[model samples]
Target: MSLTDNKSAGEELLLSRHSVRKYEPGVTIPEAELNEILELAASAPSSWNLQHWRFLVVTEQANKEKLLPIAYNQQQVVDASVVVIVLGDLQANEVAPKVYESATPQIRDMMLGQINGAYSNNPGLARDEAIRNGSLAAMQLMLAARAKGYDTVPMGGYNQAALIQELNIPDRYVPIMMLPIGKAQAPARATERLPLEDQVIRERF
Candidate 1:
């Protein structure tokens, strides 16, 4: 069965997704499909709908080479069809008016006021929110890729300082994670998971 055929295949997609490190070299993801995956990922919720996540898709071999050293020489950086750099905009709150433009004036004003109040004097809180929202988007991106029959791996093993310099990322954007997506070259190995009882908590600690 094709991965995109069923809308109710959430469980199957989640269960099947694994961190793919090896990919079929020279394969490229179609632009239409890549856009579709990104659209799905953008649907993830964010604080005040700020949509703070920023994605930098790198597919060029030369660019991948530039990222290799920053990624600690991870070979997947070069082999994957595309490497999506997920960034969180620290100044996302500044764009409140645009993000809430279609809302009723009262609602928009109220949300903007709340956003300003929440972020203006709190640098730590702002940074936390950026990471939180960006992480949600990143997870959605991975699931979207999996549902489209693509393999993905979310990687945080990289030199953040060097990456910022290499990519020329803006100071207001924090590097959150990197997702490499493509067709897997080998079968994913099985792994163990903790039981729900041990991982979940009910009502209290």
Candidate 2:
């Protein structure tokens, strides 16, 4: 059944969540469906709309084979339907004049001045902030995938340096993580979660 057609309570996105490792062999996700999910991922908010996230969708079998070794030899690296490599550009925000120019005049002036102030105050801090912002977008993509009845695994076991070199990513770009997407061979069991009272804090501690 299509996720869109299922309006049943048991099919709620959150309730249907699971981390899939093994997937059915020879299954491929359609391009349109993949784009639809990515569109939702792109809708995730970012600082000043800079949208620092960059995704590399891996489908070529040869490329996947090369990545397998670098990804800690995880069989899933080559087994999944698709592997999306999430990247963060560390220098995009520092070069934001055109970004401001694309904005409405009022916002353009405001953002230009704000960006200047941010740069002057702490150049390095802004880059780190941008990386963190990109990470949030990556999380949004994973959630959107799960919501669409797709199984995913967020992996950081890969060698970042090797991936960056293999992907020919620019020096200012950093690989954040890899997300494997497809149907789950078996449903993932729920893991432990911290109790609300233990994790929550009131207005004043």
Candidate 3:
């Protein structure tokens, strides 16, 4: 089959997804389904296969209450079936050997050498790569949720410091984004998009 045929459903899911702020009050996502969605999202690509993304799924009412203030009192923090805190591990390169455990010894050594060379003494590059990988994982999560008939909203309006303290997040893990997933309470309003001609370039900007 052609790419178009293979991607028709995926395209629909991507196009139909919107940031859902209001969710059904009593609905909860099944644990198994949540795990499956997370697995799919974790399959997103990472630099050197480091896979630095870490998800903190908050679903308990008490924990959600604690996160509410940290999230600037966003109702979705409590209303959604689950709120996933997507984090990036700044020290992900430390695990380069483990990440390439199944590879041939020579390949693993080469990967480790490359990772160490690129990341050691380069905090800025490591941080950038972590954020980029985490962002890809977050987008994959949102699309995966949509494929499961769930609505989601990616949030970045929280107080990062407060969230870290409240959640007892490790220092190495940087908070990248938050996603609230659940069934929508109401239909999402139509949104306008910039035309392809305005945003796309054939060769040069």
Candidate 4:
């Protein structure tokens, strides 16, 4: 299917909302499609343009098997066409000088100053900022997958320590979420949400 469709913006947004747990058997997500979806995900905004999220796509059966137990034995981890392990680099600014150098000079110097200042004054804040940037990227990935007619489940419940060990993720990187993607087994039922009036507060709060 072509990425560009004639659907109105609102229609696209509404239709793109669904979480799929079950998937059809023996279907593999095309590598091209996966790449396109991730390309779109990278466009998500981040503080100081610091893209701190790293996605590890688990495709091999053996690697997936190693993750199954760590993921709470969720069948989706093993059965889905793709499993995206979202890792947040807590010290990307310090570790990747090239990432900053690639940025435009205006933003680059600004971010570098902020990074250096915070690292010296408040290390905790620097760590918090990195995780925040990474989370924004993860959300973009999920929404981009949805927009492309793919179904996904965002998994947060799992054994973090075991997953880190099994995946060989470094100490500076934290596994924040796992996303299993594939076609849905059945159409998703309508999800209940809080009323807009209750959920959105005006400026007065």
TM-score, one value per model: 0.93, 0.85, 0.93, 0.85
lDDT of 3 by residue, 50-100 (tens): 998999999987888788888889998888899999999999999798989
lDDT ranking, best first: 1, 3, 2, 4
lDDT of 4 by residue, 104-193 (tens): 889888878876676678757656766787778787888788877778888897899888888888888888789887778776566767
Residue 107 of candidate 2: its Cα lDDT? 83
Candidate 2: C-alpha RMSD to true structure equals 4.3
Name the regions of candidate 4 deviating beyond 4 angstroms: 1-7, 102-110
* Residue 107, candidate 3: alpha-carbon lDDT: 94
On a 0 to 1 TM-score scale, where does candidate 1 land against the true structure? Answer: 0.93
lDDT of 2 at 126: 57
Q: Model 3: runs farther than 4 Å from truth?
A: 1-7
For model 4, give the 10-residue run with minimal summed lDDT.
1-10
Q: Could you tell me the TM-score of candidate 3?
A: 0.93
Alpha-carbon error at 6 in model 4, in Å? 12
Query: For each predicted model, how many residue pairs clash, with residues at least 3 apart or on different chains?
Result: 0, 0, 0, 0
